[model samples]
Target: MRSSVILLLVGISLAFAGKHSLKYFYTSVSGDKTFTATGLVDDVQFMYFGINTKKASPKTEWVREIEESDYWKRQTHLLVEQHHWILNTIWTESAGEHTYQITYGCEWNDETGKTNAFRQYGYDGEDFLFLDLKRDEWISPVKQGFRTQERCNNETIRLVHWKNYLKMDCIETLKKLLTLGKSSLEKTVSPQVSLLQKNACSPVLCHVTHFYPSDITVTWMRNGQELKNVKVGKLLPNEDGTFQKTVTLQTEADEWRKNEFSCVVKHQSKTFRKTLTEKEIRTKNKTAAPFDVTVVVVLVAVILSLSLIIGVIGYFVYQRKLKPALSGSASKCWLSFCRISGYVTANTSPSDSENTSQSSTES
Candidate 1:
């Protein structure tokens, strides 16, 4: 029984290990003459290197800097040179402010002990070249420079070997780090949905915040049809050891105002949906002015009619019974009618009035 309990605990811990990642990012901005780079393990920065051309040579940091010879120095120099070469090759008159980023990462599955390696080079946040080292494949834009099919294939082989080497050398350390960094499983958070308008175009945004275990999907649908022009931002870390992400769908104002849009979020095998209706959108934008005005007029007419009916009933009751019994004057009967009318009007809430108006209109 003790052995079984230990095995179960181990299985649970492995289940919560999530995806382990190691990423290298390089970014250069020509307009600002700044270059920045970092090496991250599971989204935690372990090394940072940067250079501002307006300043001195370069700044460097390695958490394990002392455990090296001049290896990092040489690597940093080569990286800076490579950045300059790529920048020169891709620079254009129209490309005033340009950025280049290279990301290499591996995701490890604790349960399967399987790993997938990825390498991507992007310009201005768009992928120009991508390599799936595990599959030994490459994807590049047609107009990208210095990236040929043969070269990419060759680089893929080298990177695959390098990834294996790193795994063999660092997997144990990385696993320990991941274990230390693992967060407790928190309750799944439902996404918040809203419509945003920019440049006369509206986009529905589903923001999922403060969730655990990183694996979540956000999908947008229009009138029960899935949308293609959807933008999903990267899953980002929160300060409190949770995760957040945003998914946006770009839609035309007419479509947004006429169709039903829904944001569906799936996390931890559970699904949540937030739906926006055309009427709700119209009401939010205050474009249902005519409908609102019509409703108000109908409500007022119903209320006045109700008050008048009640007043007549009261007047008749007073004249027939109360007036004869008390020998009341005409002014007293009028007062009773006025009091009933005032009470009916004063007791009618806006919601009740609206409901009554709608019921009458429907009838």
Candidate 2:
């Protein structure tokens, strides 16, 4: 009777064990680039994953980052042979436009409910076959870590994981985020060159204006070298929603000959760009030169003329004193010296003949 009881107990245990059904669900995606799903099962564990890209060769099988609890949990239950777990599944989109495909597949041990965690699976020339399910089916958006019915939508399904049950709606959210990033990529500041001055001035000043949404940085580069001693000015925003910065560079009179300056605009992840120098800064300088020259010439002439007049008056007073010191013969000598020296050159011209003096004697 004890033997019969043992047989009956074993049969019952086997039947109950066979009845236990373990269902593992996940999603796979494909398109531009291919990646597999992470966090395959909460109580269950990640087994393995396969990565394949069109442009590149397929990657060797690798395991995802699994938690200690997941590892320990799988250990508690004895593992069986050839158990495949859902691995990395992600969607890749094409360039220029938005399109993606998801690829994922898994094989679980039917005999043992627990998975074989130690072994790695390699791609044997056959691509993974995944059941593409509706993305909305698996998307249960959780607020505060709890899934809700309101967040679920039916149309959110992705075609990549139609075979298996992995929530694919998250791909839509990822795609949306990527699209947003791409749209703003063009909006980033691109270096532009423009001429601010049509005519050159003494110190040619170049104004660089950047049309960007955020605060901008401006640097002056002269022939690919960073400029120093440049009179840098403030950056101000225009009424029409753009930024304007002014930099004044005093080119040595020689610099105007080459006549070039560059304003480089720098922003995040942006590169070399320049604004052409203005013709006005150089042209304006030309107009200023004639005016400056004329002023200097007039100032010098006035100074020289004033000095000549003063010298003539001083000489006349000195001679009057000399006449008293030498009254008689010396007076005649002094007069002869003055005439020979041409002291009266202003009153007489070389082309005119001189008139002789009449002698009057006091007897």
Candidate 3:
């Protein structure tokens, strides 16, 4: 499954940055059967291995275009090794009762050259051990993790292997992934901006949807002055591989009518300003159908009335058509029916009726 971990934005100030990360989640439990891992390019999931699946698979179309079958083989083999290692490490008398989790990953910012590689262990959802990238050593935040930290620190070979993996191999993998998923992950898409409201009395909402590169700025302004305390929603992904966000202004509708209020959004190199006005807002609320008995009864009555009117009109329309093969007597009967309905007049010459009867008899 694709990892739900949001991109770890460290010390970011709306700067242009691109980060790629590979996260490995290993659980020593019955759930998921064993292990899972996810790789994201610019916070967009490109490849992942799940619990219910047999092997790692690409999540995006571009990643599926990868021709190197060895890539998948290597990833799957590494995950299997990691699965066995974590199981052997944590498999004890307490293993059956308590679930142990191991999360190790390497994250690198390609633009700013920031690296945040980590390896963390959790016992029953509590922090046990973590790698100190700066100190180049393992640190135990809790007393129970001391033994593990000391043991891992003593294993100098394994430490070097893991550290090098994080520093060199991991970063190389990220670079390769970025290149493979460039067209999908790096493509810039402009956001769709709109002003929305639940109803006339609801707060004004600035909805920005379907954008790329999650580093975006959405702000509310009133009379050209920036407004504060607006409720900003988290950036979410759309089914079409784009992002969406919303900023809510918790104010009455009258504020917009009295003053000039607007929502300004900055994405990539483009800027959009949506002015707040009654016409700009989609005031019609998308709500569920009413459960009131009176409304149901009225709707049913209106439907029945329309059905009856259509049936009546259809019968009269059908009766107004006269068959050409009708004899004189049959024609007379048809004319009588039409005259009763006031659709046809009784204007026919005697010769006309006789010729009609002769033509009908010959046919």
Q: Over the stretch 310-360, how does candidate 3's per-residue lDDT look in tens digits?
A: 999998777676455456698678677754543434376777666656665
Residue 201 in candidate 2 has what lDDT?
38
Which residue runs of candidate 1 sit more than 4 Å off their true CA positions? 1-12, 15-17, 30-33, 41-47, 52-98, 123-126, 132-139, 143-174, 183-204, 220-243, 248-262, 269-271, 275-363
Model 3 regions lying over 4 Å from their true place: 1-34, 64-68, 91-116, 121-129, 137-159, 199-204, 221-228, 254-261, 283-363
Where does model 2 exceed 4 Å of error? 1-201, 258-260, 267-363
Instruction: Please give the CA lDDT of all the candidate structures.
Output: 0.61, 0.38, 0.73
RMSD of 2: 29.4
Whose lDDT is higher: candidate 1's or candidate 3's?
A: 3
- TM-score per model over all chains: 0.49, 0.25, 0.59
lDDT of 3 at 64: 74
Q: Which candidate gets the maximum lDDT versus the true structure? A: 3
Error of 1 at 299 (Å): 13
**Could you tell me the lDDT of residue 220 within candidate 1?**
88
Native-to-model Cα distance after best TM-score fit, residue 93 in candidate 1, in Å: 15
TM match of model 1 to true structure: 0.49
Top candidate on TM-score is: 3
Cα lDDT tens digits, model 1, 1-363, are 234323333433644545666667777777776677776665555566767532212122323323335646766777778667756665543258877777766667676778766667787878778765555566686565345645757765666675664555345445443443344232334444343333343465567787655677788888888877889899888876567888877766556558878887777636777776543333344423122446779999999999999999999986787555565476676667754443324477988767666665666
Q: lDDT-based ranking, best first?
A: 3, 1, 2
RMSD for each of the candidates: 15.8, 29.4, 16.6
